[model samples]
Target chain A: MVLNSHQRATIEAAAARIIPADHDPGALEAGVIDYIEQTLATHDGDHAQSYFDGVRELDELARRQFAAEEFSSLGPEQQDRILKLLEEKASPFFSLLVRHTMEGFYGDPRHGGNKDRAGWTMLGFPGPSYPKGYSSPLGWYDGHLPDDFASPKKRSDHEPE
Target chain B: MSRNEAVDVCIIGAGASGLVAAKELSEAGLSVVILERGPWRQRSDFAPEDEISTKRRHFFWPTVEQEPRTWRLNAQSPTEFLSADVQVFSNAMCVGGGTVHYSGLSWRFHESDFRVKSTDGSVAGTSIEDWPISYEDMEPYYEKAEWTIGISGKGWSNPFDPPRRRDYPVPPVARNSAGAILENGCRALGLHPFPTPMAILSRPYDGRPGCVNKGFCSGYGCPVGAKSSALEALLPKALATGRCDIRPLVMAREISVDSGGRAAGVVYIDSAGTEQFQSARLILLAAGGVETPRLLLLSKSSRFPEGVGNSSGLVGKNLMLHAPGPIVIAIFPEAVDGHQGSPCTRVMQDFYKTDSRRGFIRGGFVHPRAHGGDPVDYALQPVHGARWGLKHKDSMRESWRHYLHSHCTGESLPVESNMVDLDPEVKDRFGLPVARITYTSHENDIRLGSFLAKRSREIFEAVKASKVIVPPSRLRKLHNHQMGTCRMGNSPGSSVVDKWCRSHDMPNLFIIDASVFVTSGGLNPALTIEANAFRVCDYIVSEARRGNLG
Candidate 1:
């Protein structure tokens, strides 16, 4: 059950409003739409139709408000306004969209979201320290520094800028 | 179907209890065969700290999509499908069971915990009662489990804690900086804070290396073989004995009986989907609390029509899970760097006993821990003033390094209505009726949870935390520690298992998991389960030697 072009646009635009692109990379830049699209094909496809129906509701709301225009065609301010209305009403559809968008934006990079570890880099998270775990006798407990506490840089730090 | 030669003992589910049982029986010169439903997962399989791979995907256990279970608030409610994300009765499925993925906090239940009903009197609408055995009876076994499993911690710190004959096998792990801060707060509030006894080794013991400070103990398996999981500590020895045969990826379908209505063998399906019957002199069931009872209920026969060992009609009754209190997340002024060491190093057991003044029969233990080791969990777990956008990101970034969260594990009373039974409408991949968990936290549990939250706030305030965030006071599907479905008692009328975890009706059958817990104490039941397994297996070995099993 692949999403249609109009449905994809609505979800992508909706995801942007949920975690809009600021100076930092937001949901759109994090490839959240791609994550959700991939998730719909997995065993958790029972909720896929609900997501499509939810995106349809957003489009219907946009058409009613902006004289028969799709949600993605609307301006950023108008998109934000409609999302705010959904939040106020506590729409289950909007709630589902928000959760999926967050999972995509902040979840693991291997899942086609959190593109290039942008979500982690922006938040200063070291991102899955393994193979080279933190050294023992962690002096942080006693308010003591081991000097050069930041020697082994994060895995993301080695990635090309 | 293929038939295998009969062993001296056949154990279903090679978890903490089953491993101990196999080690004891096999060491006693009895041939033992352990049939595990899950794959033979090893330490190398869990070496990586990938959150998506380990925590999200649940490398230890199969997802609810694979082995589906149903959930309902009460008996009358319409059963609904429980997803892996929200399944309440979450039991691990791999070789080591939950010990492979648990937080490694190995706590012994207090003396009062064994006889809660006797000490505090029974609460209304719950089946809370005294255990058939006392603390003194289990104390020696507790010491044995602690030494064998290699616990590391300070002893006799908490005045209310049950007495132990010897100190821990090793000293407590190095206290993390965040743990030190919480310890100071607890001392200021006049609370007795002690080093938490952990299954993870501080130093090399029992031929295993010490922890590497991986900072992934909460939900991830230890890579360095430091964590004293059953697979690491016991199973290797059992397998080394040359008398134990561990058959992984073999699901125990039903416990077969002889013509004389005695224990005979187990019919299980192999990983290749071929059914095989392995006859044994004695049968031991340790397939967790829910699965243990489900196996019994599924093995219906004409002689025992309601299911084997269910003549009391209480095989799947009296289900209980430790309902954790409102987890209060508090932020400090400076960077705590919580995700650098073990999750729990210090525990405040000031409120681990019954106190009527708090309007609760049993109290909960409050232990502060390093929150958010995984990046994804922190992003989702409600950080204050963060709906979305920059505020959410800023909150997550700041709190990831500075925040500490603590929750009280409130004791849940066993109610007859709160149980696990076969769901008529649902079936697993093997076309077997899926176990339906019917649970609603008792009123006393809710009140105790609220009380624990109030007390936790006082400690946070004492520590001068900048912001204290308390979630809603409701028990969700946090089911890492589940127990008490196939309860133990002296009488056959009120319980499924006897004092030694042997089924009342069946002489050669035994259940050695947390399912035999008469009461769920305010602590992790893994240590107790392991202790009871060692204890019961000792009895089984003696019986096998005497040729009394038949």
Candidate 2:
């Protein structure tokens, strides 16, 4: 289920609105669109039709209200207005996109998003402390372990790109 | 080519109950063969410490895409298709069943739990009944389960606890910071908080090490064999007895009954996808609540058209799920770090028994928990108004460590309408009908849940913690303690299995799982199921020695 240029633009723009780019890397910089695309291509192909229907509806709404041809062509303010309409009318699609966006941004990097572990690093998460599990008799209330406890370079080095 | 074998007893599903039965029967010199639907998972299979691979990979449960179940809130509603991954009623499909990935809160139902109907009267719409066997009859078996399976906790701590023959086998697991905070709050409210009885090892026992506080026990298997899963505790001993043959990836299709109306053999799909018939003198069904009823419902013979041992038409009826009533969270300035120790290290059981003043038939327990263990799950919890970006980031940083979650584990009443049956339309990968669930919380259940939720709020307030968040009132569809599809009772008219977990209609067949639970108690049902398994095994062993059973 390859996404067309319009589909890709719509998804990327909508994902950016969910987690917009700022001083820190947001969903766009975190590669959430790629994550969603890969998910739709692989395990979650059943949800592809929902994405198509949602994008079409958003474009239709954009044409009616903002005099825009497509959702991606609109400015940030106009895009948010269309998103709010989607939240009201096509909530199932909007909520699904929001959930997938969160998964792509916050889930493990191996799933195709969270590039450079940006989502985790931004949230001060050290990924999973596998094999060598965390042990603190005093508990997590004491303090977090050093960031050096897990190395992103060493962690991603072993995995196939 | 398919191979045929014969054993004295053919047991389906090598989970908590089946493992115990196999060990007991094999040790008594009876040949036993156990058929497991899923692969034989070992410690190596549980190596993935990440939740994504462990949970998402379907390590503990069946994949919903290929094997789906249909669900409808009531009989009138249109059934919606749900993969086992998304289905709330699904349990483990591995070597040890749900015990492999269970949180290990090993609780014994109080004496009153066994006789809910007799003690508390009927709750209007529900058909609650007393078990054929009393708590006194089950006390010795509970002790045996504790000693053999190795539970860790002090006994007789809770005054509301039933009479115990002995204490737990080992000391309780060490408490995390939340345990201390919960204890202080409960004590301030004049409630007795005790160390929760858990199956996890607190000290090196039976060649297993103590818990190391890894903070991954909720849905993940223990890296070490400290969790006391059947895969870790019982199955190995059953295998050691050479009289037992444990075959994994062998799915039991149906039980074949002889002209005498007794279980004669089982036709199953082996790992190679070849059909094989394993003849046996006796058959035991321990395939959890859903699968046990499903297998029985699937095997419709001329003698039993409505399914075996279902003469009363109750084999797939009376399904009950525990209500994980509204959750109450307390916020503190400091990080209570709930993830560091056992998830259920301590519990306040002040309301374990029913009080008429509470306006509910039975009460629930307040068990404190740590919410934000991992980053992905922590990030999913949003602040009151923050959507994303810096505001969301700020909320995650400030609130993740500070929040402590506690729950009211309440009892769900067993209504005839709430049930598990075969889906007329949907089929699994094996080309068999998948289980369909029809359930809705009873009116009394909703009231009970609301009462419990109110109690949870009071406990959180007593702690003097900031930013208390009470989850919205809703009947949760999630099933942690699913039971009572094939209820056990004295009369064959009202039950599928008798007091000994043997099918009343089929003398040679037995069932020893949560399926035989007449009433689900307010607490977790793992320990009670294990204890009942031990009792049933003892009955089978003695009866077999007397030549009453094959």
Rate residue A147 of model 2 by lDDT. 17
Mind giving the per-residue lDDT tens digits that candidate 2 earns over A23-71?
A: 6688889999888888888867888999999899889989999888898
Writing each residue's lDDT as its tens digit, candidate 2 over B78-152 gives 888764435524677878888888888888788888998889988777989999988998999889988888899
Which residue ranges in model 1 land beyond 4 Å of their true spot? A1-11, A37-58, A85-96, A136-161, B476-478
- Residue B12 C-alpha lDDT in model 2: 97
- Which residue window of length 10 is worst by lDDT in model 2 chain A? A142-151
Report clash pairs, candidate 2. Answer: B64-B84
- Docking quality level of the chain pair in candidate 2: incorrect
Best by lDDT, which number? 1
lDDT per residue, candidate 1, B89-157, as tens digits? 365788888887777889888888899888988778988889999989889899999999999887786
The positional error of residue B466 in candidate 1, measured at the CA in angstroms, is 1.2
Q: CA lDDT of B373 in candidate 2?
A: 61
